[model samples]
Target: MAVLCLMLLLLAGDLAAFMQPPVFHPNPPTEYRTPNCAQFRLPGCPRDLNPICGSDMATYANECTLCLKIWEDGHDIKIIRNEPC
Candidate 1:
């Protein structure tokens, strides 16, 4: 009876551990900024709606807009993903 109780306790412990929610570690927060459009000569981007995500965590209207910002601001901005941020 004691051995059976010990086995049941062990099983219960395992079950409890399994039932616990998973823990996830997310990436560290990044510093983002809004580009100063007025301070620089803005390039005339096309009206096409090709969305893109930039390293600045902003959703540019398209890749041309992001490139224009990078060129005007002299910042090393890169494309984070192909989707809108």
Candidate 2:
């Protein structure tokens, strides 16, 4: 029937919308600033892994991608100041 076809079309549209991956761009208008946690300055570590730009309260899952960018660009990262939590 016409009603059944209309319902199926609406359901398909709604499902398609939800299937797309969600994008989280916090600062859309501003330039994307990658945090400088940099290399593991601390010595005597089993393995040297770059630090991520997240805090005790929250974690930025996107930081892993940012770290890779900094490493590839050969940017020297240093913790200039301790940010207040």
Top-lDDT candidate index:
1
Looking at model 1, report the run of 10 residues with the lowest lDDT sum.
28-37
Number of the predicted model whose TM-score against the real structure is largest: 1
lDDT values, one for every candidate: 0.74, 0.45
Give the TM-score of each candidate: 0.49, 0.31
- List model 1 lDDT by residue over 1-85, tens digit each: 9999999999999999999998743543364434444453457767789787788778988777887978778987777666676
- Candidate 2 weakest ten by summed lDDT: 76-85
Candidate 2, residue 61: Cα displacement in angstroms equals 26
lDDT of 1 at 5: 100
